[model samples]
Target: MSEFTNPGFEARFTLAQAETTPPEVLAKLAIDTHAKIRRAVALNPSTPIKSLLRLGKEFPNEIIENPIFFLLLLEDPESQFVRLSLARSTTTDEAKLIQLFEENDPDIRCAIAQNPNAPLSLLVRFVQESYQRYDDGSGTTEKVNRILRGFVQNPDTVASILEELAYLSDPELTQAVLQHPNVSETAIAIIQAMRGQRGIPSAILDQLVNHQHHYVRYVILAHPDLAPEHLLKLAEDTELYWDLLDRRETLPTLVIDRIAEKTFQILMSPAPALHAAEMIVLWIARHRNTSIALLQAFASNQPDYLYQHWGEQQFQNFRAAVARNSSTPTFVLRKLSRDLKAEVRDTAKTALRSRKLSES
Candidate 1:
């Protein structure tokens, strides 16, 4: 029997696994059979611009599904796809995000508010609009509040915006701000004061402690004026356990033990490949009190998956995340300091300096 190896065989095999194949290989596979292979090439971050453009003409859905390609589509300024995708992307550029905010499509505008990367100015504007429409006698208040809730949950929403929302007499709106991850201590204090001498009511605190957003729950757990009963209730929540451990220094001994046990259980569980989980692993790696056992667990799970799998723009983002991580090992920084991307190298050097200063 003849060997199954041929140049065409290699091309077909590599294109079949285009998700991990190199860009040069993907460039060759871009013109391969119509549906699956070309779609794979379109989704591959390393696919060349020419390949993407060719695919765009024939397979716009494939282009739309590829986030990097979607952003490039946005550059056209005339494509309706740009407006639609920009509405959903949390990573679109600030200027384009601003432009999307002004688009005539209210649905698209609402989507921009939902984007995690949406600017604080836009969020503040939405919150203000919600407040203004609260008593306008029209039915717009509920819709405006629904839209502003997205802004409230965004980490980018500034403390000033949260503070402003806290002053509003609407209990639901104020409660939403209190659950924000970025809500300042000063804003919490203002909210606490608004509730009168008895303290934030159990119902509101209960709801805030159970907020779906981890960062929001973290903020609530970190609040100095938090009610003792609320803290105990929050400590019992398995979902908030990591955030609780992340603030170990402030937690009571019993709470710390619970958090540690919960964290260890999660560590022993099968790890997921989700980006959010990977980020949490990196964060736990940075904590000063994280155990050697946990560090060993993370050694194989370093956030460098991005560097291995992503194209230029996404790789730079991964490098930036590593640079910002204070606990990123020195060896990693040394390697990153020589990265071809100037931003990556500069950020690495800056992080190294910060690490040195902190050590001293």
Candidate 2:
């Protein structure tokens, strides 16, 4: 028979949430008719391994998504499936992760290496394994290479691993390592030197600019030795411009000027929806070196188009933003200072005072 006679979902859910719920009852509730009850039981720390394992199989996503449950499932010896699921989970611990890596199965190691939480130890091991089995590069070697590629792509892979991978004689592997977000400045210098010796073409620079990995592109932008020409090139690339805007403060004056020119056009364009215009304005207003003319023009013309395009709250926010802009023209500030809403008026007055003090 069932543990609770015709129990409602609420009662089972409440029982599952109780820490003191007996192991037997927890086990029974894990298999309860309602998924909500099972969800609560999967979260409970005191739930027995058997019950948790059962939940892992029956409701794999629930077990995989919860760090607490996934870590416990990793420790279960009876279910390789459950353990493999933990290996794939982001929250799996380092010790179980190391154990998973040590196994002979390439698929298991690859799965672990792909996990964002794969610790440095696993990454180091994966890198070391990549160099081994150099015999004509058969099945295991190919799989290991794939695992190494996954490590290069994983954001959490350590900088040290990336630096070490930069020295590989294999050009493709070296290129992949360079594309990693964690690749250090020193490693980049070494790779550039190597590229010079190897006669690698300048087309690689264009490829790096368009790298699918945003962080990799960011690393290229932030490279200390990056040339003004390259920075300008990246700034002009439509795909990389937004990323350029994100780092606008630290960018060279020339690069920032170029970006501002493009962004101003986007802000002035009537074809793109008002939301896009507002986003550009926000970027311009928030960033350094925004043109005074741009701010004043937006402050003046935005209200008419903005009110028509924005909802009531959004329009209010736009007005408040205009009030806060120090670059907003004095006439616009004075107009906002007398606005009907007290909040908008107060913000304008404060900005006006600050602007006057700075001018003095």
Candidate 3:
């Protein structure tokens, strides 16, 4: 009962919890009779490496959860023990997980993928790497697939990540994602639709037509067999409009019209348009399928304010893009041939000559 035999346990615990406590004191407390006090020392950010190593044996989880543990890893990044411990711990913070992932150790990355707390961004990266490996017939295909399977099995995996995994077209991974309880109905429908040799069925297309998920709608839009009506319906979503304009596949004439109409409206609005809107207009001008009428509109359409605000170089760039479009009519090209910008005038004259040569 004496003070030496039984120090005030609560006071000792308080001392163990203080950041200002000396490292030597923490090292002593690391082996204190009270388990809770030792645990506190283990969790303390200020815990010295020697004491932490000892406590890690007794409380490995606590040691890995400590902020000092991450700092230790930073100092000794090649330490297998620290790297594996941090990678395997669900309590590891995103910053530490990012660092561990960069080590590019296959085993470490696999552990991070399996960790439920891994950030979605990291999970997406794993999926992309795995897809590349799978495509190239690389020797690490099996290991990367293991990483991807861990990603799909992780409870934190979202529908977007699942969609990305499904796109890998790996039969095993796709099946696992489809069967996963976390997969949404929208994701399931899209996955099933994508697997078919035939185009999206009307019934499923109807269900997904208004789906809120952008990836699902993007998949639907990318399907070569998608009907023109569905394509136009999806086009109404302003969020997808930018992506729609960038599609490499020839879009329906009506869809192109919709894009042209919307771009004009946004440019003509009283408020200033976003730089993204201008990019969309440029894409429309460059689209090979753009109708003559829309090309004519773009050829002549110049907002004085846009020219003034965007500066002469950018304005000339838009005209140059229009002049480069093969779909631009002869009359529009002739007009562009006289453009003040040398680049636009040269581009327009070249296109006009090409058209005449083809006709001859």
Candidate 4:
């Protein structure tokens, strides 16, 4: 004000405005913009995820009903916040959805089945409810495909829903569920679930071995529960097993070495590819010690390896066995502590420190 050129005046003015914002006023203003809501809720998730869900629920019906909006936030940079936010929105009963399920109109049933943010419990409940009403005339198959749309969009969560369903199901439904077309992400979840339920038909495992989707086939191949026949089949699916090299991060440790070997083979084939060489190094870094040993024998001539894989964030929401007890003494803890990727290293260290402090 003195010279109309005070360098820090704008900064001071902004701070004063922020300070003057009443708690209620600021909360209201924070709710006005989705991006601002994201920032506010991220700063204060301890408050509740529903703070932003209120914003989503305020939208016009058309906007609320748009699958693309859900899809957008599914991959949104602020998606984790939005997901937590919407996760608390009210849940409707299968009763509300049942009539829609019976409607001859596929779109209505599609809508009934495909609400992107529906809870897993709701999905499983509706599947059962819809099946009860179906009786060969209820059009359950069409609804299954509609539900599958949700499964494909967010496979990780839907997989858990499917797993929970698998546990609570009779053999017929469980059998059909495993063979569902979107078996990509659900295979591992279902297998992990069957540990207690013991109802997953062996046929599902066999079908998983030859499943069309790459993810389904790879997960089943990596299963410790796999019988010798499954292993023998994978060993013979030479071309298919080699294809797993394309996505080694999702592959479990059991087959990671095989995938590494295949990548090396593809790299050295008569026509060499640079991507293959680079990816082999990245795969080696992920599975680390054991795969590193295999890589040395597989790619002795490969140049100095500097892998730039960043997956720690996507992995945060999924429950890993290593995360169950929150202990840090395990081998994974040591490997992750030294992970070259900054995100992986930081999250691992944070998790270990939190676990130590909690145990203390």
Q: Which is the leading candidate under TM-score?
A: 3
Q: Which pairs of residues collide in model 1? A: none
Sort by lDDT, top down from the best: 3, 2, 1, 4
Q: Which scores higher on lDDT, 1 or 4?
A: 1
Candidate 2 residue pairs that clash: none
Worst lDDT 10-window in candidate 3: 131-140
lDDT (C-alpha) at residue 73 in model 2: 56
Best by lDDT: 3
Q: Using Cα atoms with residue i matched to residue i, what is each candidate's TM-score against the true structure? A: 0.32, 0.38, 0.49, 0.26
Pick out the ten consecutive residues of candidate 2 with the lowest summed lDDT. 131-140
Which digits, one per residue and each the tens of the lDDT, describe model 1 over residues 116-153?
67787876665555444433534345555676665576
lDDT string, candidate 2, 109-227, tens digits? 76776676778777766665654543224324666666666667767677888865664446777787788878887567556744544333455455455544343455466554455
Give the candidates in order of TM-score, highest first: 3, 2, 1, 4
RMSD of 3: 12.5
Off by over 4 Å in 2: 1-215, 224-232, 237-242, 251-280, 303-308, 311-316, 326-332, 338-341, 357-360
Q: How many clashes does the backbone of model 3 have?
A: 0
How does residue 320 of candidate 2 score in lDDT? 73
Off by over 4 Å in 4: 1-203, 218-224, 227-257, 270-277, 285-360
